[model samples]
Target: MLSLLIRGRFPSPAVADVGAGTGLLTRELAARGFAGTAIEPNDVMREEGIRRSDLNFPFRWLNGSGEATGLADQSADWLLMGNAFHWTDIENSLQEFRRVLRPDGFFTPIWVMLDTDRDATVQSVDRLLADAIPSFSRHSDVVMKFINSLSTGTSDFSNHRVFLDSHHSEVMSKERYLNMWRSRNDLQSALNPREWEAVIKKIDELLVEEKVVLKLRTYAWIFEPEEIPH
Candidate 1:
C-alpha cells in the first residue's frame, strides 16, 4: 500500500500527518524513508504519540490539528489524513491542507476498516453492535463518504483511488482484538459505558479462538489540486 502511494510519486517527501494519533501512520511514513512533522491536537494523544515514537525516526510529533496546523504555508509535499478526516470539518480542513501544501503537493486520505463483507467474525461483531446499540450504524458508510467527498464540491482535485477490493489482514489473539475495541473512539462514542461493556463481553463470549485473523480493506484517495489561472 505504501509502495503504491509513494513509489515514483514523491522524492524525499515532507509529510504532515494530521491527527496523528499515537503517530502510527507517521512512524510508517518514517520507516518508508519519508520525513516530516506529525500534527496532533489532543495533549494526551500527542504525548502518547511522542512516547510511541523517538528522535531516531525521521519525524517529530507536534501540537496541531488539520484545521490549524501551525505549519508554515506551502511546506508539505503531502498532507495525510489517515482516519483523521472523520473528525474534521471537511471544508475547513481542506482549505488548511491546501494552504500547507505546495501547488504540486498531494492530499492523501486513507480509510481502513474490517472487511465485514468477507470476514464472519467482523460481521458478527457488526450485527452485535447494531442489535445491542439502537443507534449503531455500518462503518462502511463512512468509507463511502470518504470517497464521495471528492465529488461533492470539496475541491478541484485530480483524484487517484486505490482499489476498493484491496485488503490487508492481521492475525492477533482474541485478547488483542477485544483490547482494540476497548480503545476505539468510534465504538466509545457510539456506545454508552454499560452498553459498550456488554457488547465487548458478548464479543468475548462469541470468539472461541485464542487468535483471530481479521481482514481489513483500505479506501485511499490521492488528491492533487488543479492549477488555476494566474
Candidate 2:
C-alpha cells in the first residue's frame, strides 16, 4: 500500500520507521530498496531485530521515541508508524514528524484490524473475548475512537491534510491468524493466567471446529503537510 502510494511521489525515498517494534516494517521498506532508519525505544525489541536482520543491506537503528526521533531536520521523505501510533502522544509526535520530514514528506499510520462484522468466525471470537475479558470492549472502543480521529483529520493536525484508505479481506490461515491475536499487547496484559488459557483453548476449538480463516483489513491514514502560498 505504501509502495504503491509513493511510486511516483519520490525517487529512492529515505524512510523512517518510528516506534519500529522488531523492525518488521523497516526491513520490508529496506527490502524494497528504500533507505531506511528504524527508531525504537525498547532495547529488547531492537536487539531482537538486529539479531534477525540480514546483514547484507543493513539499515540504521536508533534508540528514540516518536516524540523525539533524534533525526536530522528535514531528513526523511516518509515517516511511518506500524501499529504503534496509538501508543504515542499524538500531538508531540506529529510535531516531531514535521520537524524531521522534508517539506514534501508524508506521514502515515497503518493498522491491521480484524473485519469481525464481515466474518462470522471473527465475530464469534470477538464475543468470546468479550465474555472472557470484561474490559476488552472498552479498550477496543478507545482505540477505535483514536483511529476515527486520525481518519477524519480531527487529531489537531492543523497544517496537514489527511487521507484515509483501506485494503480489505487480506486472507491468512487459521494458525497464523490465531498467532496474531495471541501477540496483541492488550490481550496479553488484560488476561490473567487461567482466563488467558481458557480463551486460547476456546479459540483453538472454534477455529478447528469451524475451519476458520482470518480476513483482515489494512487501514492507512496518510498525512501530507499543506503547502504554504508563496
Candidate 3:
C-alpha cells in the first residue's frame, strides 16, 4: 500500500490524511518520501502523532475531522481517508474530500485488513469475536457500505473508481498484540471489558507458532473526478 501510494511518485505532492489518529499512516507516508499534514480530530492523538513523527520529513499534524479538515480548497494532491471512515459522516466527508483535493489529484480510502474470508485462522477469530461481541462486525461489512456510498453518497462530484492493491504479513507477539488491541480507542469505545477479554483469550489460544500470524491485504478505492472544470 505504501509503495503503491509513493512508488515513482515525487515527494512534491501533498497528502491530506483525514482521521489520521496517531499518525501511523502519516509516518508511513513520510518514510515513503512524501511531505504531508496529518489531520486528526483528537488533541491527544494529534499530539502523540506529532511527537512520534520525524518533522525533518516535513510532516505536519493538525486537529480536524473528515467533514472539515481545515485545509484550503484544492490544496491536497491526495486525500486518503480510511481506518476512521466508519467514524465519519460518509456523505459529508465525500464532499469534503472532493473540495480539498486538487483537480488532477486522487482520493483513496485504504484498508489493511486480515484476510478473514480466505484465511482459516482469521475466520475462526472473526467468528469468536462476532459471538463474543454482539455488535462486532467484519471489515468487509463496512467496506460494502463505503463502496455503495461512492455512487450514492454525493451528487456534487462524480467519482471514477480504480482498483490498486498491496499485501503483507507479520507475526505479532502476544504482548505486542495485546497492547495494540488495548490501545485502539475505536475498539475500546465499542468493546466492554468482558467482550474485550474474550477476544484476547480467543486469539491467544489460537496463536500459530506462539504468535499471531496475520495474512494482510491492502484495499484502496481511488476516486477521480469525472470532470474538473478549472
Give TM per candidate: 0.81, 0.83, 0.76
Q: Give the Cα-based TM-score of candidate 3 against the true structure.
A: 0.76
Better of 2 and 3 by lDDT: 2
Q: What are the RMSD figures for all models against the true structure?
A: 3.5, 3.4, 4.1
Local accuracy of candidate 1 as per-residue lDDT tens digits, 90-140: 668877887888888877778777777889988898788878767778666
Clashing pairs in 3: none
Best by TM-score: 2
Question: Positional deviation of 116 in candidate 1, in angstroms?
Answer: 1.6
Q: On a 0 to 100 scale, what is the lDDT of residue 152 in model 3?
A: 57
Which segments of model 3 are wrong by more than 4 Å? Answer: 1-11, 130-140, 148-159, 180-199, 226-230
Give lDDT tens digits, candidate 2, residues 1-230: 56877757998788889998898888888878887789999999998887777767557888999999989999988899988889988778878888898888888888766665677887888899888877776355667777777545465533344455554665567777678678876786887778787888898888754334566666676766443111
Two-way TM-score contest, 1 vs 2, winner: 2
Model 1: lowest-lDDT 10 consecutive positions: 156-165
Compared with the true structure, model 2 gives a TM-score of: 0.83
Candidate 3 lDDT tens digits, 1-230: 54565444534788888889888888777776777788998998888887886648566788789999999998988778766776788678877877888777877777777666557776776677667667777556776556455455343323544365566787887677667656656555677788677778777777656576667777666755334212
State the RMSD for candidate 1: 3.5
